[model samples]
Target: MQTEKVVNYIVHWLKDYATQARVNGFVIGISGGIDSAVTSTLCAKTGLDVLCIEMPIHQAESHVTRAQEHIKQLKEKFDTVSDTRSDLTPVFEAFKNEVFFDGDQATVDMALANTRARLRMTTLYYYAGLYKLLVAGTGNKVEDFGVGFYTKYGDGGVDLSPIADLVKSEVYELGDFLKVPESIMNAAPSDGLFGDARSDEDQIGASYPELEWAMKMDEAGKRAEDFTGREQIAFNIYKRFNTANKHKMIPIPICEIPSNLL
Candidate 1:
């Protein structure tokens, strides 16, 4: 995709949405990942008030540092850009100790990670409400739609999704065009939820390039058998994630009564 065209589209989309909603600006959680960096930059380009919040829950120091750097760069370019950091380690620890202390280790680990995401979501909304700003989402197409690799009512909850249509590769392309800091652009994509800082590919069992290809093939009605060995394995993994997380990608199902029963 043409970087300039995509940037222009997102900037105009944000401006138009804010005008329609009569909101003052946007509030986005900066995760130091390419997705957030790109989204924050697009929001800042609108010249409206944009708050880049760093909500870290026992996050890696490197992640925090990169986020700060990105925010600093944003401030240099857009006077409307502002930033604040919220450490959520205490709250997360409390939840784990009070709620999931006796749970299975695997289950507890997953719960704790999800809690971190939800906490960040809460923090973003808190600032959004206080400043009359919309919560801008940073999820991309492959993660948000193809695999549903996001927390429901957590990272998935947002007032606006500026880059939801772009794939992971497309996001990196935009990041390069926007001149995002090399530290952030080059870093492995992680949710920053786990303590060990496992990359998204590590957690998901497939690289983004593989997943993106699988998604495109699936969209074109291709089956796993079309490929052999490793490629098939990747496609199967993609299908499994998509199936398991379908609920996160769609609206809640509702029961309907027959028309004659009205």
Candidate 2:
């Protein structure tokens, strides 16, 4: 399908969700990343009230600057929240200072990353409640649902995700079609929570082209649930979601029946 048609479809679908939910606007975080930039642009074009929150906690100056540039170019209304790292540092420190090593540096980093996500989510939700707006998620198919790159109930939480079905490459293609600024499309995709320590590709270990192929293959039809191939590297991310099964499903409590029931 043409990118314009798809983009229009997504925007209208999101508007329906907002109307059905009785929301006045949408809030999205712009991390100088393509996914968020594309999402913001779509929301702006769709006539939805979009608030682009640039929360640069531990992020580098360049990332924040590029994020602002993208917001400006998109002609979207936005606000900056600085020193956010100070607000979230205590949460990360507490997790690290815990008695057990259940959370190591890597784990701590993940938690810290999630803390940022949750903080942003919380802020969005707060504004959503205040203005009766919905929180529009910027996650693409590869990151949001495929590899489960987002934290449960943190960045993963959203009232509506317009691009959730579009893979990363497709999202970029759509962005190009929409005339999203080159800086946004050219910027390296990152969460900006790790402060240059990691990138989307670095964390996922496969380019979006490869990831989209795997996803399309998985969706089309597969001989086995485990399909190994050149895409194995990308598929490993699927393994992470599988191994962490609890994260995949809600925690269910076992029922204890009394002897009388027998």
lDDT of 2 by residue, 29-67 (tens): 777888887887787776767777776666777777777
- Runs in model 2 lying further than 4 Å from the true structure: 76-103, 220-230, 240-246, 249-262
Which clashing pairs does model 2 show?
none
Q: Candidate 1: which pairs clash?
A: none
Q: What is the C-alpha RMSD of each candidate to the true structure, in Å?
A: 1.3, 4.4
Candidate 1 lDDT tens digits, 1-262: 7889989999999999999999999999998889999999999999899999988887888888899999999999999999988988888878767763666888878877888889989999999999999999999999999999999989999998999999999999999999999999889999998865689999999999999999999999999889999899999999999999999998999999999999
**lDDT of model 2 at position 107:** 86
- After superposing candidate 1 on the true structure, give the runs of residues whose Cα lies further than 4 Å from its correct spot: 257-262
lDDT of 2: 0.71
The number of the candidate with the highest lDDT is: 1
TM-score of 2: 0.80
User: Judged by TM-score, which candidate is best?
Assistant: 1
